[model samples]
Structure formats: C-alpha cells, structure tokens
Target chain A: MVTGPRTLAQVSEGDLLAEIFPYFAAHDGLLIGPGDDAAVIATGGSVVATTDAMVRGRDWVDEWSTAADVATKAFTQNVADVAAMGAVPTSLLVTLVADPQTPVQWAVDFACTLGRLAQESSVAVAGGDLSSAPTGTLMVSVTALGDLGGRRPVLRSGAAPGDTVAVCGTLGRSAAGLALLQQDLGALAEVDGLRAECVAHHLRPVAPVEAGPAAAGAGATSMLDLSDGLLRDGDRIARASGVRIALDSELLRPDTDVLAQVVGGAEALECVLAGGEEHSLLATFAGALPDGWRPLGRVEVGEGVTLDGSPQAPRGWDHFAG
Target chain B: MVTGPRTLAQVSEGDLLAEIFPYFAAHDGLLIGPGDDAAVIATGGSVVATTDAMVRGRDWVDEWSTAADVATKAFTQNVADVAAMGAVPTSLLVTLVADPQTPVQWAVDFACTLGRLAQESSVAVAGGDLSSAPTGTLMVSVTALGDLGGRRPVLRSGAAPGDTVAVCGTLGRSAAGLALLQQDLGALAEVDGLRAECVAHHLRPVAPVEAGPAAAGAGATSMLDLSDGLLRDGDRIARASGVRIALDSELLRPDTDVLAQVVGGAEALECVLAGGEEHSLLATFAGALPDGWRPLGRVEVGEGVTLDGSPQAPRGWDHFAG
Candidate 1:
C-alpha cells in the first residue's frame, strides 16, 4: 500500500481511468469524450473503421520494447488501416486488458504515449474498456475511426490489368530490424545508421499516413497498407482484382540496395519481398504516380504476385499459422 | 493435416478469414465490408462508438460458457453501451486475440454467433483483427458504432433535480445467475423456471436496445445502461449530473419481488441493489415515463445514490479490484 510502486490490483478502475482520461482531452468534432458509456463523434458522411490488437510476448517483448513502443505500434497499425482506406484518422477506442499484477505505471505510460500520438495526429481519444486478464497477460487493442472526407473508399478489387503498383513508404525495414534483433543482442549496440533505423522501424513503425488521402485524390484504383508484406499484401490485391502483380527487381533496387547495406544481399531481397509490419501505403494507380509514391510493379492479366515474373507465396505473419 | 479437429496454428489467417467472411454479408449502409484494410460505413449524423473487451477466464468459464455464449455477451455488452447513448447500433468491429493452440472451431462458432446476432440487430459486422496470443490467452473485444439519427446524445450528465428515475429492463438477473453459478452446480438442473432464467441471463444477457432511442425521443434528461450494477452505475449518473438518485424501495418491488422468489429476500435485495451486467436502460425522465420504462427512483438536488434516504456506496464489478 506504500506508494513506492503500485499494481493495478491496488487501485480502483475509476481511479486509474481518471488519471489517464486527462491525456485524452476533447478534440474537434468529438461531441462527447471518455466519461459516458460511449463516445459521440461527428462524422462527415462516411466513417472508416478498423481494429488491431497486440499481445505482450506475441507482438513485442518487454526486454526490447517499452510501453510507448507497444502503444505506438498498436496506434499506428489501426490508423494506418484507416489511412489505407483513404480516410483521415479521427478517433481511437483503446481497450487494455491486463493482469491484475501488472504495474499501473505501465498502463499510465501507454496511455500517455497513445494520447500524445493521437493528439499529434489530431485524432480524438474516445473511450474504451478495461478488464482484468489471467496472470501474466497484458494486451492492448485499438479501434480507430476515420472520416472519409467525401472520397469513395478505394477497394482492393478496383485494380485493373493496366494499373501501376506503387508504394509510399519503406519496405522490409521492419523485417530487417527484426532480423537484427533475432540475429544477436550484439546488433543492438553494434548497429548504427540504416541498421539502427531498421530496428527502430520494427519496434515502432511509422506509415505515410498523408499519402493515403493523397493517393485517393490522385485517383487510386486500389489500395491497402502493407501490414503483412509486399508479396502477401500485393497478392491480396492481385487475387481480389483477379490480376497478377508483376514486380521488376530493377524497380525495387532503391529499397533493397539501402537494406542490403545493413542486412546483406540475400536477406535484403527476402526482406524487401516478404517483410511484415511495414505499414507502408501500397496502391494501384491508372495515372502517374503520386508525389510521395514510387513505382514498384504493374498489374498484368494473370493471378497472384510475381517477382521478376516468378511466383511468390505469402511469407509473412499469419496469426493462426505459427 | 487430416481435418478431424484443427487448431488455429494449423491454418493460415487468410484461409480462416475466407471461411468466416461470408457470415458478414454487406448491410444497407455498408460501403465496404471485411477483407479490406478498413470497413467503410455511411453515417447520417453523429456516430456513437463504444468498446468492451472480455477475457476468457475472467469474464467467463469454459465449464459454464460456450463460444456462442461469449460472442453473445461480448456483442450484447457493446451494443448495449451504444444503445444507452441514444443511438441505433449500426456496425461492429470485433477483435479476437486467442492462443494459437486454440481450436479453429471455437473461432468459427464465435463468428457464426456474432454475425447472426449482428444481423438480427440490423448491425453490420464490418471488420476486425485476429491475432495469436500467448498460451492460455483468449480475449474478445467489440467496438460498436451507432448512428445518432439526428438526435442529440442523451448523456449521463444531463439529469437535473426533480427528474423521475426509471429503468426499461431487468435488474440483478445477471448477478443472480452469476451467484447461482458460483454457489452450486446443483442449482443449474434442480432450478428449472425462474432460477434457470437467471443463469441463462448471466451467460448471455439481453438488453432493451430499442428503449434507448425511444427514451431520447421522449426527451429523457439522462440515461445509461446498468453495466457495473444499479448502485455503482447510478452513482456514475449522479456524480456526472451533480445530483442525487433517490430510490424508492416500494417501486422496485416488481424486480426484487420476482428475484426474491428465485434467490430469497435478503439476497434478492442485494442482487437488485448491487448486481452487475444487467443490460437494462436506466434513465432520469423530466417528463412522463416512456412506454417500456418503469419508475424506480427520483433525482434530487444532491450527490450520490440513496435508498429510502439512506446513502449507498457503489458495489459491483471493478476490473482491477480483484
């Protein structure tokens, strides 16, 4: 009971909520905030909604990632999905289901980072639930709501045979970072520059959020965020559109070349082709590429994704497929 | 891979999604459904959003609840929150974080029940996330989004002095059911009629979802769903509205009377007073009681909740208070 350190079990839910609720102040268009049973947000015409959850050991380990890192990843993943729909991120409902033994400080830190990031993005921190979990459990789930701003949602089925495949953010950096981490703890101290950037991207990846609406405005045929991998997510567009995505190795040099310096040639190619959690915007455009986007491939009359005309199976995170 | 009984770890994410996505057929206002980065839904005015998450062991036990029961409770709790905000439930984003070793049948059955319930309620099962969790972890979260239909949100902070307190549904039934479960296994079979109803209500409690908008339409001053229990939740409305909720034990006879026969007098009073998870609509009406609502108390120019002029403290589920 001494205030040296406190577990959630030592505090009331109302007390903890009162402490964190201040971080999520009222934002524009938020009619009601966190006090009520539900939050009221004024939407334009359409709302883009998505949810993403992360488990403690599954998503990130405590040794490598902090509460802020977890919050960043969870928040980014949800809003990136909203952005991929060509919608501006508006609000987030965050659910924290932690073990009673978990420290209150961890939750407070997570809420602080989540609130700060949401505010920086001009997103409202809407209310969510808190519940106790089994011992040793700590998980966070974020449901992000977005405003479409009168744009028709760009679907994966809209890509045509003649469309150009383009991406607006880093490729394989997250995977490369994971590889570094997995390869050795020595990499953490010895790595620098691009290698360090890769590790950072893996822990708290950032997406080209603005480029999503920009691509939509520039007449994107189909779009999605690269949460899985280039091959897997690209194959999603291909399968959905009933067309093949043909990627040129020459076109992918800009990314692979940079990654090769950090993780070597073969691994760099693999990372570029099949890395997960990139959070980049991948879209098919019938016209010229958008400002922040670079051409990656082309949609052809076939099926699935191809690298230099060779088929590539999905090689990324599959929730059930351990 | 002989398909007798399969674990989630045996299947790919897309394969599982493919099998379950059909359950969520498009609704009228759904611009886009699952399979994309985000689901796009059309809204008329303000959107009322609420989220609730349940852990496997904490919220329910495998010995007492099936996957269908969990789905029902999760869906009900979320929609109940949205309805309590004076809005019509429109769509839901469900996140399932489960152990990879969990059976595929559990996920499928959950989705089937969830999709069916959403359809029955005219709610779209828009899109959500599925991720593997640590061993023994199985959690489900639901974020329900609703349309305000041009009506102002009926907040808990709107109750003024001299308002009549009314409730539209059952009280203490869920907690009574929980008590029965925790007390005796013999109660399940030996108790047939009303006692069985209590147990069933605890497993999958139903809400008077329609009464929410109707109360708002009737110009009710304030309202909320009895989630954490009448006493605890009533205190919420009182503290928010800066008024006292004065209860009349005589008027609550209808609920306590029926409960008394099922669980006895002393316990029945406890259940009616502090029982939790009763998804009933409680409101303070400045005018006449609505069609389905029954008067139970009054709003006075004070603070907290009082029973027969005696002060009562908040008692019910507190997630971190284990």
Candidate 2:
C-alpha cells in the first residue's frame, strides 16, 4: 500500500524524493547509479535509451495533475519506450527547471515521486539537474536507460508478413480522462473505481513491464509502444518492417464496452485505433502465439496499415502537424 | 567561427534545440541517447553521472553573456562537477525550455555553439528534450556521463596529513572576469592581455580535462575541481578527508601581476583563495611530489583550511545560503 501524507498534494517533490529513495538500496552492479552527485549504471553489454520532455502548460497541471502524478506519468512513459524495444528499464536521468516562485519543497516532493516510481520499476533516477527558469513553466526531461539482457533487441524494423500482431495494456483511458477533465465532467466522481481509473490512467500509466521480456523470450521480431496511437505507431512498425498491417474490428470489441456510451461506437473504435499515449506494448510475433496472446491483427504483404483489409479512416496525433 | 542567421534576442528555445542537435553524429556505443524519441549510452565497466540545471535570467543573459558564452559556461560548469572525482566526461544530455516569443534562431545558434564545444571536448550531446516556456526565460539542464576507465576513482576523500597539494590550470581569471563584468570596468579593456582574460574567463571556462586521468595515474590520494573557490573547496576536501590544509601565499605571488591593477595584491590573493567556478583541478598526492607539480599548499594533521598556517577566512558559494 502507498503510505505517507493523506494526499500527495500536501507533500513537496523534493521531500518525496528524499523519502522514498533511501528505501531502495543500491546494487553492486550500480557502480555509479543513483544518490550522491550522480548515478552510474553498468553498460558493458548493451544499453538502449531514449529521452522525452514535458512542460508545465503543455504537459500537465497543478489543478488537475499533482506533482506526484506528473512524476509517475513521466517515469512510466519513459519506461514504455524502453519496454517497446524488448529491454528491461535500468535507469532514468531527469532534468528539471523551476521558476523563482516555485516552492523548493514541491520540487523535492516531485523528485521523491519520481524516485518511488523508478524504484518500483527497478530503474534508478541516477542523476539530474535543477535550476530556476525565467518563466512559470516547469520543464522536465527524462532519459530512460535499458539493458538488452543478452538478447537481441527487437527493433521497429523486423516484422515479417504473416506474423501475428498483438498488444498488451489498456488503451484510450488517458484520452477519455483528458476529455472528461476538459469537459469538467464530475458526474463520474461518485464511482471510486471509475474515478480512480480515469485519474490513475492519466496520472500514472502502468506500462506492460513484463510483456517486453516475455515477448523477447517468445521470439518477437519487432515491437513498439502505442504512444502516438495504435494506428499511427502500427504504421511506423509497418513502414520500418516493410509489411502491411490489417486489423480485425471483432477483436477490438472489448474496448467498446467502456467507451461506447461516452463517445459512440464509431468514435470509440477510432480512439482505440488512433488515440495516442496509451503506452501499450504493440509487437509482431513470428511464430506460434503464446498461451495468453489475444490477437487483434496480422501482418500482410502490402506496405501500409488497414482496418479489416481496408484503408483506416482516422489519422494519428502529430505534435508538429496542425 | 560561429555562424548563424538569428540574434540571441530573436529566437525561441524549442526551435533552437531542434535545429542545433542535427549536427551531432551518434556512435554505436550510444544505442539510444539523443534522438528517435529517446536516447541510450553504453556502460562499459561502470558509469559516473550528474545533472545540473541553469535558467536564463536566473543564471545569465544575452544582455551580458553571449549565447556561446552561456553555452560554454553551462558545459564547463557541469563537466567540472564530474571531473571533480577524476572522471572523464564521455557524453552529455541537455534539455531546454524557451518561450515562443523568444528568437528561434538565437536558440539554434546557441545549440550550434554548444555542439561545437561538445565536439571540441570530444564529448557529444547524446540526447535531450525541447519544450516551450513562458516569456523571458531560458532553462537548460545538462546530465553529464563519464567513464572511469577502470581506474580507482579518486574521490573527495582519502587525503592524508602528509599529502602534497597541487593545482592544474590557471586560477583567479574567472573571478577577475566576473569582477570586470559586475563593475562594467572598461579600464581593463585598455590592458590587452587583461581584457582577453576578462572575456575568455567569463565567457568560456577552460576545465582541466586531462588532469583527472593524470592525477589518477600519478597515485593521487584525493582530488576535486576548483569550482567553489580554492579556499572553500579545500575546506570540503579537508572535511571529507578529516585533515587540515595550509596554503602558501608565496606560491601565488605570480598571479599578482594580473590582478595588481583591478584588485590589490591582497584582494587578488583573496579571489584566488576564495573565488569560485574556475574549473581548475585541485588534487592531493601522497609521498614525494610528481615532476611538473605546481605546489600550492600542503595537507596537514588537523581540520579546516589555513592560509599561511592560520585558519583561512570562510569564503565559498553555497546554493542555499545567501
């Protein structure tokens, strides 16, 4: 159970970082990772890494997302990127900039939240920078480090035609939560489960940590995370692997149950297809399906993605695209 | 030579980061460090790392510091921290936030300057994140990675009473340059050599990159960079090593000519003894002095740092203390 203050809002980020980090002891292999001035990781084998940045007005909010929530969201999002490569997360290096008006306590609490999440994910915060910003924006950039663990990393470019396409983890809950937040819809507040789901999904996404290792163990050829929407991310894999992807709507029916009443069946399908930031593991398996596998699509001989063997209707999220 | 279209005042920060990062070419060791949605650095034995952030307005500015100047300052400052422990800098990950109203090209030029410096130092900007912030502020945070090269890292500890103290690189130039900046003294501008020192020392701090490995090779008992003034930093080494340090002012007489005009001999000595951010390497060695060692002081049996065998005045920069 999560313990500490009654609400995360009360604790500052720096204090939180100081609190949870000491609980997780360092390993011998972690020669330079975490605590002291910086954290170092053993990287003799192979290290897979990626970096992502989040800003205050553009990324999250104090009114809706707490410091802890923002920290959790950032940590998991980076974790998902490493997991997509069929690698286990090993370390995280963070950089933060605050304004003069920022409470040092809040900064500390945010760091603690980040540390706790990293500890839980078996990743170390390692090292980071702190400074004052001229503006009010709170900027956070996180570097995610992963170890290949002696296996060949599954890249975005190895999917072969006739391979099974599958995904693991929830989708569209974050978008739905955002929509609800945008609309200021509080009616769902009474239901603990629904409210918790909305908030948790948006604040702290749980990426399929085990799925990547399992897929690697099962001999997956190519993989990626559904960060930019299933259709869009699938297209990336397709293009990289030089294969076409065909999705079956029947298998996606499971998503309709939660989203149909809110946005209608068609829109629900579109969100499930094109809504981004789900952080679900989307991969192509070359051989027989594993026991727990629930397939939603298949790779074909063509060079693009299709819905039920036809061109899909919706486009995906493009940060620079208007 | 630096080349670009936009002036520092005319460009925004996000666009700047996007423009300048393309110049860097990633190596095989950097599996995921900078682009393609994330970054990674291979850990060959173990790794040493740290992160520090700087904010425009809070740290420096175009009105005073040039973009190239600020870029160099940021790099040298962080590199010094990693170098303090006898670690060799291998890569850097930078994250920046700027306003839309800010000049985009200025930031781009800044990135170019940063990239050039990274290349010069044999370090690459491996990965980073760019985001938008409010007006008038530029926030930059850097995470530095270093390779120990299998040598036992000479930490701040391990200094014994009989160890000899030595410094690699120049001292008091940065402090002199800072004085010139603060006083707006054009008088020093007439002195050709002094003017150069004022400009170069303030704009680009030259860190003792080779000194780390050299000290490690020479059987240094303890080592640290002279970032937080010689006297103050010596105190840190003293506290960490649980020994006293005595500085010989006679060895510093050669520096008086440079400072005789701006600040008297006493004040010049004070700056060299207590000024911060020079980035020179201050290290202690056991037994006989190494050839080419420029002796500045000696480690003694008691605690505290002494100037001419007396307790030195308390002078050092503290982030929290006013």
Candidate 3:
C-alpha cells in the first residue's frame, strides 16, 4: 500500500521499497545512503567481508522460523563465514526481500534481531536494502565485514605433507539433533543428554572464533570451518593441498560419547565421520598442536584420501543426488 | 561426489581450512591477520560498501542462469549498489552454497565471472567461500567496497520545496522488458526497437557511472537512482523532504518512447511512472537544471503527490500489495 493514507490495493513493488528506506536514515555509518540503487559504508583498510542468504523453504521453516529467527540466522551464518576465515566481524549489511502484506513489524523484528546479534557478536548493523517479492517466501541476504587487524589471511590452500590435522570445538551434534528432530524420536530421548545435545546442535551454533587466531599464531598450515560433513570437507583440503589425507576413525570414537547410546559405536563413528554443520575449526599444523587442538589426522604427499592409511569410499550429502 | 580419492574425506573442514591460509601471503594494507575469529581491514580513511544476493528462482533462472550469469549478476548488482551511492567500486567478497554435485567448472565459471565483472567495474574479487548444500540451488552473495574520495554523499533526505527533480540515464526500459519477458510475448521482434530495449534492459544494465559524480559536483541536495518507478520514487523525496511532489508527466514522455509501441501511451506512462531497475540517477536541485538533466517535477511544501499541479493517485509498485 502507498504510504500517508494512500491505501491503494494493488501497488507496485517499487513503491513499497521506496517507502521502506527512510526508516534507516538515522544510521551513522551509512556514509553514502539508501533508496538509491545501493548503500555504502566507510571502511578503514582491508575490510573483512562475507555474505549469506537464506531462502524461506530451503533454509528455515515458515512455521517455526520467526522473523527474528530468520534475521538472526542470516546474520550468524554470514558472521560464521568471516569467523571461519579467522576474521573479526565488525559490521553487518542485510538485504531483505519479502512478499507484499508481510507485516511491517516482521521487517522491523528482523532488523532488530540482526541488530541484537550484531551487537552480541561485536559487530554493528551497517546498512541494507529492502525489496518486495511476489511470492510467499522471504529471502534475506546478509553481508558481514571483519577487521583483520593486520594479519595474514587464513585461506584454504596451504596444507602440506607432514602437517598434522587438528580441530577445536564440538562436531556432528547438529546432524544427530536434526535426525532426531526429523524422525520425531521422542521415545529415544534418553541417550546421554541427546535431546539437549540435539537442540544445542540445531538451534544456535557458536563458531570457534578464538580457535582461528590460536591456530594462526601457532603456525597453522591451513584451515577452514566444517559446514559440510567431515568426510567431504576433508576432501576439499586434500584436493586443494594436492596431497593424500588420512584419518584414524579410532580417534573420533572418544568424541562420540553423546551419540553412543542412540546409534551405537558404528553410527556414532559415522556421525563424527560424515555429519556436518559442526562449525568447528579444522587446521593443519606444521609443528606442535596448539593448546586446545586435538590431532586427528595427517597430510601426506600423494593423492586421494585414506582411512587408517587405506583408501576409503566417499559418503555424504549431494544436492543433485537422485 | 566427495572428492580426493577417499582418505582425505575424513580430515574435517576445519583442519582443511586451517591448512589454506599461507596462500594469502600477499597484500600491503593488511592490518589484522586472519585466525582471530574474524578478519579486519584497516581502511586508512575511506571505505565504501554494498551487498547483493541471488536466490535461485527469484532472481534468475537455474537452467538459463549459467554460473557465469549467476556470478555476474551477484557482482554487478552489488557494484551497481555502491556506484549508485556515488562511490567507486573497489573490492568484493563472495559466499556461495550449493549441492556438492555442482560441477567444479560451475564454481570456476562463477569465480571467473565475478572477477571479470569486478574488473569491468574497476573492483577486485578479494575473497570468497564455497560450501555444500543438500538441495541444489545456487545462492550467491556478494559484498562490495568502494572509495568515496572526499565528496559528501548525495542522500535521499535533503530535497527541499522548489527543488527541481530530474533524472540522468534511461528509464522505463527495464520494467517494460520485464513485462514482455514475463508474458513470454515474442512481440519484441514485431515492435520496432522493442527487442533491443528488452534485451538492453534485461541482460546488462548499465548504471550511470559518470552521472553520480556529476550530481555530486553539481551540488545535488537530495539524490537517488530511479531503481523503482518515478512517480513512486518521487513520493519518497516528497515524504523525506516533507513536501508535495508534482510531476509534469509530459516531461517524462521522452524516456518512455521505447515502450510506446508495445504498451501504448497510457500503459507506457504507467511503466515509466512505476517501473524499477532503471538505475538512473534522480536528484532534487534548488536551481537551474544541468545540460542533460531533464526536468520532470518539483517539490512543494504541501501534502501528497500531484501530476502537473493537480492531485494524482499513486499507482506505483508495492511489495506487499496483492
């Protein structure tokens, strides 16, 4: 509807967006401005940047995903990207596309959640664009910036032979929790705090922010976050590193304590091996492990991946899998 | 499709990511190092930023939107955002998530497209992320940075009563073309100049790179791009300036000529009034117009919008409108 008492029923999407931007006029870092084609922010030197977008049906639930949840999800997910690269998130920019009739408060709530999360994450809500869509789904695109206080970036292309692979933070709990949630296994909820574990793994993921710097300072050879399953993510390194990687399944058994009761040792092993969204820091060390690092594998000069020094088959999620 | 021959699949995304940092061994203005949870960029003084994202079906076609198109759209859209704010595009960071089965070449093409677009826009593809998603939909998010020199940015909040409203660059073409594409009308071939208009407005939208600085230099008070329709966008200035916006309508006829043959005069007028994505600079100035800036309207201290001094109902796009 047009603003200021013009409640026309069938308004164009552009008019709606034209109405939304004036609300953001109070932002200070909005150095440029909005309601133009884009918005601009002031930066210092090297801007730490990352972006993530959430599709309604794909990334979250319209039923369970509140406006706040959707906003928080978009912010945190992009924040995690910067964190994965061992950067300090400083500011956030959001692009929200929602259908007409989406309660105005929904947009406000979304921005408020983003603001709260940004503050909590030590970042500020910088700027954004708001547009109207023709569909029921809401799409939120988030861009996060980091302040990389003059350090070499941690990329995903430096592991070498003899580099010991180590990790910091929990793993596979999200996948297991998701499985439980999807299966509605309410009766099997008693295995080693499984319900809480599942919820913890699913609801809010805390990325290993400190581990990135710790590993970087400790002379890490390479690094990345585990957004995908371990088995698949490991392969990313192996290919990028142009080396053969090997892991000991036995090493992951200790971390499977929470899953031991529900799925037994074998399934727990699979969780550690194939489950994902752990957001843990995985790094290859050329020397001694960092303080909290646990060595789980090693890099070798060759090709492909091996389990217990033997070739293992690849098993994980595939988007196009039929 | 978990790569690396086998064994490396067990290494973990974290450990693998940790191994890739040393490759980012270049760069001068690098302030903060990666690995501290987030990266920091020291902007020295000037920094410009913008964000844009592409959701699968909403923004582009999955089958027709090649990885290159996807990448270009992501980069160009963000670049346009920064440019629209009167800043020179500088650097970009991208984040992507898709099914693992997405051909590696698709990723490569996307990257190359991003790089090429950045080059065309005088920006650099500085950083990015790649991840796996269960469902196959390409989600491309890009955040762009720009250098603002020292010009005070033109905002949408400074238009004063009596300020002449003018636009720089073509308008109505994109929206008209969009309508044609949606209708799947092959009439673009039949209508004189419709095909070029449709394709020009659809594929590669050229933002007014020179006009932004010109407007800034010309001391434009309140400025913005005509991303949405003119009548609707004009209302934005009216609301922000607390003034009534009056459009001559006849003055805007020149810009709508391309749509006349297919849409006729009335429909074409509507398209020019509310069609978006033209990316033409619209600014309100206190005095005489510049050489290329055609006068379309004026701001007056009053209420609502008027066409040629008479109250006119707004028929522009509304995101939430049914």
Candidate 4:
C-alpha cells in the first residue's frame, strides 16, 4: 500500500490519470474528451496546428522556475504560434515525459495551472499523454489547434513595401527579468515592485492571444509572434516577404524606457531588441492599425531588418547553435 | 560555416531547419506548411486529436532500434490513436527534444523516414518543433489529427451486453518478437523465417489504419487500439462499458498458433494475452462484423474481462507503476 507523498513510481497510471483528468473541464467544442483513445473536437473548415516542447535544464531550471511557471511558458509558446497565424486558439493537447521519481505535486501543479489558463482563455484542454522518461528528466510538449474563422491565415510572407509595422504587447520585460534573475537579484523583488514584475514576466509570459485574430480582422498583411526577439523575428517577415523592415529607434523608446528603469538605458535597448520568449504580436498592416497596437516602423523595398538607416544582424535564441 | 557530418551543436537552427524542411512534401490538405509558425489543414466537421511520446532510454535503446525504427514506431503510435476513434488520420505535428551533441544524421534519418511514410499514408506533415535537451536525453512527441467524415465517434463506453467482440489485426506477434530479441535471437532471422518476422514485427509494428472507420461504418459500438496487451486493454473496455468481455480460448487459437511457431505454446499464450505495443484495432459490434475482423469474444453483463468462464487478472505495461 502506498503511503503519504508517494512518488510516481509508487502510483498506478490509472490513479495518476484519475487525479489529472479532473483538472480539465469539459467545453462545448469538445465532442469527446479525455478517457478515450482520441479526443474529438468541433473545428472550423480549416484548422491551424503547431507543436512546441520545453525540456528541463535547457528551457528552464528548477532552481528558478516552478511547475506552474513552466506550464505557463509552455502554454503561451504554443498558443502564440497559433496566434501568429492570425487564428483563434481553440484546443490544446499536452504531453509530459517525466522520470518515475518525480513528485506527484509537480504534475498536479502543472495541470492545474494549464487548465486554469486554458479555461480563462476559452481554449479547452482537450487531451494529453503521459510517459515515463529517463531519471532526472522532465519535459512538456504542447500542440495547439486553432480555428481560422473563415479569415485567410496571416503568413509571415505577406508583408509588402509601404506597410506599417506594429506590436501589441510588452517587448523587453521578459528579457529584462531574466537579467535581474541572473544577477541573483530575485530577492530584490520584495523591495522593488518593478524588479518583481520583471522577474514575473520572465517566468510566466502572457501572450496577447486575441490580438492575432484582431490584427487579421483589421487587414494586417503579415504577422508572427515575437518569440525569438524583435530583430530576429522581424527579419523573418522581411526575408520571407522579400522586403525590408526598417524600425525607428525613437518609436521603440517607450518600451526601452520601461526596461531602462531596471536595467539601465543601453541594456534596456538591447533587451528590447534581442530578448526572446516575449510572446507578443508583431505584425504589418497596409491599412489602419488595430486598437492596442503601437506603430513601430514600416516595410521598405530592401532586405533584412534595419534600425533607423543601419542594417542589423539577426541574433536571438538558437537551440542548436553553440 | 558548418561542413561534414557535424553534430547538432555545430549547426545553427536555421541550417538545421533548412536541411530538414525539404524532406516534407506539401499536400492539398495542408494550406500552410512547416515554413510558418503554425500549419493550416482542412478538416471535416469534427477532428480527432491525440498526443503520444517516446523517450530514448525508456522506450528504445540505440543498439536495438535505429533512428528510422523509432520514427516509424512514434508515427504508428499516434496514428493508431486516431484510428481507434474511428477517424481518418490526416495530419501530424511532431516535436523532438534532443541533446545538442546528437548526431545530425539521426535527425535527418528520422525526418526522411517519417516524411516518406506520411506521404504514403496520405497524411500531411504539418509542422513541428525542435529544442535542446539535457545531456544523454532524447525524446519525440507526435500529435495526430484525424477527420471524422460526419460519423459519430465510436467511444470506449458504448459497448453493451450481447455485443460481439473482435480484433482487426495481429495480436501477439509484437510481444513474441520482443521475447526473441530479449533472448538474443534477433540475429537468428537468417536461419528461421518465423524468427525474422517476429523481429521485424517487434522493431516496426504497423496498424491497419484504414480499418478503423470501416469498422465504425459497419456498426461497431465501441472501439480502441490494442496498445497495452489484450487482457489489460480488454479490461479497460470492460470497465469503461461496465460489461464483461468473455473471450473464447478456441477463437484465439489461430493467433496463439502463429506465435507458437516462434516461441513455445505456453509462452505464446502468455504473449497473446499480456503482450503490448501491438497497435491493432479491437472493437465490439452489435451487427455484422467488418471485413478483416475476426470474432474474439462476446460482451456479457458483468465486470472486467474473462477467458473460458474464468476471471483473468489485468496485466500489461504500466509506465509509472512499480
């Protein structure tokens, strides 16, 4: 018989599933939910799908991040990919591979946070898989499915010359927060509100999920999530669309100023331009911008991304690069 | 500039993507493919979704399975989940988390084999993610989406008393093969045809993927994939449907006989009853059985599964159970 605080090895798969299933509430879109071989969902004519994974030690360290924090980041990253395609995220399928010795509390915390966030966003936690991994390893993978709602998907290759580039969420807060944490200033959050907020942003990013469909509805020609930094992700649109994205340094001052308060002026500017995992919506529009969107720059007949008149090299997170 | 047979750490993410993207061919169902943040696919009124993952050391050993073998098993497992729901699998999203020092050829081999199989199956390779893992860890997760074609999903809880229980594919070959391999008879294939077939079955098990929807169309009341052995998975249907699955030992003789050629009679019987990873379709029908399906038992008003009027204990693979 299992006693108090039993590890996963001591618990049966059925028992663990019984514990995890209750966290996911049913929704109208889910025709068939968990407990089956596959989940059936009512989808639009076209469905948008993407998968992303986060591994412990590489994507996050247990010393600085909680299970809830990992869950939040994993959820945001995948949903943001669907949002980047100008679609409404409707359902998610999560997969967790963990060592048998992993604490039951960790899985419970992750599921509770993911379910709560998914429900709040009106996205159903349709189904998921659980498997045992090697010792000391824990990884989570999420596949987000979205509905296009009859709108044409906004691709990264749709930007054209003379289009106004805009952004809909915070830029450098996450990166600035990482900087603070690296300096062992996490304890400073109790004394400084701004520092705490930065740390929180870095740990749990909230993507402007609705802004994706909104930008499409407002005639945005091209869009993507600001995941791999502003400069690097922006350059993707520029190269794919065969145009140049020219950003005005003055236009980014507002975002840079917010980071400057914590990380100083030069470092803030760098963070705003080069920080990854922001999960913000970056898009280009030929017409008027959507509400809550701030203009950043414009598309020009050139190549790559530029700041003012100078071309900038693409630099951001690369999983394989040394 | 990266050259030669370099490790993943020696190549940039962009170079790796560029190398892998060409392997995936575009399909009409895939409106948006891998180049974008998310893939867009055409679906029926309802879509079936499921996710499954396999870890390196836990699920496979490098000496026993090649990268291509792993890819095939991963693809089959996810697609089998969709098939179990009586849906036509249409698209897949894959994710790989590996150490940076992993050989580039492993990734290339996996992608090439997966793309080839997906094309042959008429399933589109939609989109995927790649991330770095801790040292000595490798994992792959796949999310398969299927079209229901306007049919009601055949759920696990729909079987009633007097239903005919049947199976649509091979049963104990996979487990028999694993036994032969475990006994170091994998290299004895040249001397014995049956041993070779068993080895092949264990290495790459294939499911009758198209038979699922056909069974549903023929009035199957309940259906699921035989992934975790016959007795254990049969018990699941029995518990979920609140009926007893009574198997006739005489009806299972053919499958047992086939396995008996490689292994002894008693061992073959054990494999037929308790072997896992078969990926075959098991269902109960209230009407005429579909083609390629053979009768195995009957659903009776009771609890759990039985064989020859005797209660059988549920035993199969449990990822977390000690």
- Fnat of the models, one by one? 0.91, 0.48, 0.47, 0.91
What interface RMSD does candidate 1 have? 0.8
Q: What stretches of model 4 exceed 4 Å from their correct place?
A: A1-4, B1-4
Better of 2 and 4 by lDDT: 4
- In model 1, which regions exceed 4 Å deviation? A1-4, A185-191, B1-4, B186-191
lDDT score, candidate 3, position A109: 69
Give the whole-model CA lDDT for all candidates, comma-separated: 0.91, 0.71, 0.65, 0.91
Q: Could you say which candidate leads in DockQ?
A: 1
**Candidate closer to the true structure by lDDT (higher is better), 3 or 4:** 4
lDDT by residue for model 2 over A123-177, one digit each (tens)? 7666665544553657777777777787777778889988999888776776666
Error of 1 at B209 (Å): 0.2
lDDT tens readout by residue for model 1, A1-322: 3666799999999999988998886797898989898999989888999999999999989988999999999988988999998989999999999999889999999999999999999999988889999999999999999988998888889999989999999999999999988887425634477778898899998888888888888999999999989998998999899999999999999999999988899999999989999999999999999798999989999999888989888677777776
Query: If you assessed candidate 3 against the hidden native complex, which CAPRI class would it receive?
Result: acceptable
- Cα deviation at A194, candidate 3, in Å, is 4.0
DockQ of each: 0.89, 0.39, 0.31, 0.88
